[model samples]
Target: MLTSAPPDDASPPVDAGRSRDAADARFEALARMARGHFGVSTALITQLDAGRQSILAGAGGSCGATLAELASCGQTIADAGMVVVADTRADQRLRDHPLVIDNPCLRFYARCPLLASSGGTLGAFCLFDDKPGELDDEQREFLRDLARLAAMAVESDSTAARLQEEADALRANEGRMALAIAGSGTGIWDRNLQTQEIHYSSGWKSILGYADDQVSNRIEDSYRRIHPDDLAYVQASMQAHFERKTPSYEVEHRIRCQDGSYKWISSRGKVVSRDSEGQPLRMIGTTTDISAMHAMSERLQQSVDLITCLTDEVPGLVFQYRRLPHGEAFFSYASAGIWDIYEVSPQQVASSAAAIDAIIHPDDREAYRASLDTSAASLTPWDLEYRVQLPRQGLRWRQGAARPRRLEDGSTLWHGFITDVTDRKRIEAELQEFATTDFLTQLPNRRHFMKHIEAELARIQRNDGGCAAVLMCDMDHFKAINDQWGHALGDLALRHVATILREQLRKTDMAGRVGGEEFAVVLSDADIPAAMAFARRVQQRLAATPLAEGDQRIALTISIGIAVMTASDASVDAALSRSDRALYRAKESGRNRIECL
Candidate 1:
């Protein structure tokens, strides 16, 4: 739960008549502004008292509950800055609170404090919704701006009430009226529309760095001091108020200061008097210098632009990924390169990762999810190489690397990069094939075959009861064929025999060329009878097929010797030696017949 400060006691009590009505109107306007700007379901300006919080103004819903039941606003005031809860149900501090469990049932909430000029937090400007949501950096800054405006409106209302109470006293002392206006830190203006003359207080002249006598009372002179770009907008606002189209003339624009530099200012006024025909006769308002706020907004925008430009130019998908405690995940920020990597736009996955997940290879999807879960649990750097089936690229490989950090909200956030690694994976597969394959026959070479037999021997030892057979086969009179028909035909004959071996063997069997004229085979889960049957099929197939090149027909035959591999066998070489001895016996017994030992 969040620690909250005691309620502020510095707030002045609000009076109940016209002053309260005016304050409510201003507060409602600000609440509506907050609701529209944030696109939330509800917005409110709430004032906090000793033990209760009251809603001064609300938009989108009505609060029927008592002031004491709404404790969130008091917490916001104690925060003294912005506070965001992405999901109220996921928060320990609010999940059991009455406001969350009852009507409105808020899930998302964001609040900014309304601070008094005396440095006390008096209330809060808040936005909320029934669905879980979050805000970006720019949205947070905009909320702060709205909160500042709400605070200023509150202060202005209080000051207006105080001045009205002292109106009689001020009328008796003219100097005191001027002092009160100046002390409020804002300038006052009175305009006579019929006479086309304006009167400004000493505070008003001082805002533009001018003495009271140095400025003119002519309305045309005031227009000349406004920046050329802002003249039309200012004039339009003023004309609208004069025609009674708007309730007030309120505008923020640039004005030329005494030093000839433009400074931003906010001007507010309303017609206080009218003629018999309803023509505007007089207007009164206040002006506030807002150059500092305008400058800060400009700098913030520049920084945001710079960061966006840099991230867009990166070659891979640079992103911030977040995984909630409930196993939900999304990409909060993704760079432009997301299009090339996942074949999906960044905006498509900004709120959910389902679009990207749909493209992952079905066979690899489980491993992908498991890898992330492990990394998130341990808070380790995640590294994964996975395949994806993209719409445009077909089958492709991707490599991702990220560092995970646990957040205060029980979510894991990662700063990561994902890049297309299809080319690298293809190269690695090709290199592996070259190392293990016999180039001419496209079968396993001697070294790879020996390693395969060793693995089989280990498996036999582990299981202790399965039987396998190793066979050694020699091509009959290979040397004579090479000498008479040339080495090329002899090589062709060897490949022909290799093809027969492949065609006759079971899927579980292995075959490889171990010598110039010799081949080896391993039959898994086979006994003596099964081994002899396989040898006869290979010999018959070889004799039935002949190599014929331009009417030269050559019939080939292979002699096979089979030896059973037993669990008692010391090594793969021991089984091979027995098979070799059996081969010599087959050759001695007149060549073409198979022998078993």
Candidate 2:
């Protein structure tokens, strides 16, 4: 269906070696699907070359935006951001692109690069249209997310192909089941349990593809028609129902149809009359043509078999999440992968769906609930990334994606996968921290400290009666320590001082290494008196602690400055300046004391 060749003899297989493209039918279908969703004239998986670009899939339409004009793809690759130009003509860079100047000129463009796990950009998925276009934030996010999926498809082609094969097999089995159910026949039967007599309607004979005259009215005829293997089980079940152990008599068994082949029959009946002795005198039921039902059941068994196989082979938790109309959530099925991430087995989660939900980090639960509500309302796929708290492992990153279905009864079901993305998230966090954390003290660097200060300032603005304070700390005669001992001991001294700060500060208070041998703390909701007291505690603690090397101990001391945020203090910088001036006073008044302003 996605042949990249020309029609008839002129067509040739796509040149895969010359360009990087999915070159697969599935990928082509996905490209077209994206095109449909975007309502764009052209959508392509393209290999964006330095000077030229080649369409790998979809319509193979060329975009008018060239490198000299506005190489959106080039910019996307360089910045690693999804690029979108709502109106190319309005932008000077793109206004000169060929598409904007030519007939049937393209006016809108958007693209997300297909980045490989190796961190290399591998072409891109792009959309272009003749008319000006725009996309909302959610739509852009979806586009970028879809590009990630596309990258996976391209990278893991073999896995996708194997899944397709299994899907095809399942679909074929479904077709056969449907045919069997459609060609079924029904019959009627009644029996007098007390008299040991049986009666069969003409329809009952016709159900077996036989005339009424060919069948006997005796109960033996029914017994002889049942398959030997199914007779015992059918008889036991019906006996239980007749003895009042079950609510009704219903059983399925194979019976000989007229064409010499066995067909499945589901016989059902209930006792309409009872004797005075509290015993059933007679019972009647209808026999359904259930040959198709048996076939369908077998197909279902095969489906479960495949599901079990795939679930075990997959890398993440597979689950069927259901929410009933009455607001009850049930986890119908869960894979063994649940043990790896949640520290709980599949059976445990299945036993109670809330067990998994409850383990989500408390701070993340509200957003998770809101996402679920929105997805259920719009029947949209739920793609969420959040943190989960494991009893022993602390908090970890988890990404869940579910395809939702709404039932007639107002219940919702989601077939989804939840993967443990903790490793990736941790690496990302480390990379980000490396940029904003001081390597020596392992505290926030100057830039990161400013961000926290701004956030706390915003909190104060939002509060009706709020207060905050800043503490500036500097090591006294730190230069002499490095000169007397060595830089290694000086580093040790910094680490020791960092430890002291962490030990003395509350979790709500933030400490940062803003300069060499200089540190600062931002205390939320702290008054001037509290700030001054905290500074004195740190000054005393620093005076008591000493850094020891093999045979000698170096006395350690610090100068502290405190400044509380005031009504006239316009910014964090203003309060920080006041604290710095106070710190100067502490240093001037004989180095090892506290000063407040």
Candidate 3:
């Protein structure tokens, strides 16, 4: 039903202006071979120009067609490789094609591109059938071989001359190709599954420390060379490909070298030929030595594991902190101890320090930022002790020390450690309290009390209208009390008087047990009359509150002397002597009375 034209008499000439008869005869032989090999009804060697396709030669009653008529062949040439439509009517791109809907309706079509020696696609070697059919792997490979022949025929003046030239070029490049493959530590392999014979390239033999003549070509010999532990795995991988469960065979395993030691290798292959039942008949692949890569990977893992172990065992949070030039800061690395010190996980601060910053005591956060800024500016060591109010631990102290380094990117990185120092800080505070406090009454001891007096005197000397009074008080009948009630009652009496004095004083006033059965008070900002009134109140309170224990009552009284400490007094002793003289006169008169000097 389809029309055909006679071969164009004015068709473009073939390569090198070969006679039309000779070129057609050469291509006709290749076309006939393709038809017989694939059992197709027709095969055509066609040459394409911009407008139309010219049949250079034909087999099985084929004729010339235009480029639009052989749409599948044009696609093959565009693909620059084999293209097959098992059923043209079943293909979306070709279902409406002219050749598929017309007389001699093409049902199946397959073609391979005819590549010129210059690597450009010239046309395609095409097959056509009136019935839908498919090509197996073996048939596909055969079609490719035939297409290669067609390409050579189109490029050459004579087939024999082209073959000789190809042979000479192959001989010339063989050494260089082998050297390159050997230098790259890659080897080629071909296996005939039917014959159970294998061939290795010279480079492949050299990988195992063997010369080309020293290695065996038998497939069983190749199996024996694989390490015993890896042989079963390698066989399983290949079997999977043979069963068509995998697209190709690929595996990494050990193989025994010529010296009886093992080297790691990676093998990859694909089935190139198969029998009628689809069982693989031949395979081709490459092998690469991977022992060096494997060893380096193992060493890298060991190093990572070692560093992890060391960091976990350290006592504090060992960390790396980075501050960008734009003033953004984060901890790049932190050990597990971050949980113990900051009550937060390491991951919480990995990208931003905001989580850690939120826990810092509000009063100390400004100081913390300032310290870091100063250190970064000076490129100096960062050392700080600050407080944090953690969710789990409440207010706690942390001590951190680090050395800052400027990175090449104009950022700063600090390698540092942060530790919980709350316990140490508590102990220091307790020691300080012990040094300044009286053991019996918990008041400021004489030494500490004198420091306050000196400070008050200095304030008065500053001439700011500051006035203060110093009072010296001595217990009357102290010897009699100790002898009658034992020193235990005497000490209780002293404590009882101390309690009364403290209760009567204002926050600005200070009292201390200055000596055995003697006490002193400094009334800040008080004149002599105000000081005398304070002394009389203390005397009356002690008289009323006698020491009573187990129905035994012991009366207590103290004689207080007040001396106005003027700004002219150079030292604390001047005021102390005046107060003592006044106290003597009060004791000589009635005890339990207040006097002033």
Residue 493's lDDT within candidate 1 is 90
Task: Look at candidate 2 and give me any clashing residue pairs.
Answer: 6-11
Candidate scoring better on lDDT of 1 and 2: 1
Estimate, for each residue in 1-597, the C-alpha lDDT of model 2 and write its tens digit. Answer: 112222433212222343323356655765766775666766767544343444556532445443222223223223366878788778665565443565346778788887776776656777777788899986786577657656655554533455456557777463443333223333556788777777766657777878868877677777888899998998899878878999999887899877889998878898878888868888877786656446645744665687788896788888888888777777788887878767888777665578877898899999998998888889899999999999888889999999887864899989899998999998998999899999998999999999998888877866745878998999999999999898999999999999888888888999999999999999889998888888777767766877889877788999988888754557789889989999999999999888888
Winning model by TM-score: 1
lDDT measured at residue 399 in model 2 versus the true structure, 0 to 100: 96
lDDT of candidate model 2 versus the reference = 0.74
| Residue 509 error, candidate 3, Å | 3.3
TM-score of 1: 0.61
For candidate 1, give the lDDT of residue 257: 84
| lDDT (0 to 1) per candidate | 0.82, 0.74, 0.79
Off by over 4 Å in 3: 1-304, 462-465
Instruction: Put the candidates in TM-score order, highest first.
Output: 1, 3, 2
Query: What TM-score does prediction 3 earn?
Result: 0.55
**Model 3, position 558: C-alpha lDDT score:** 93
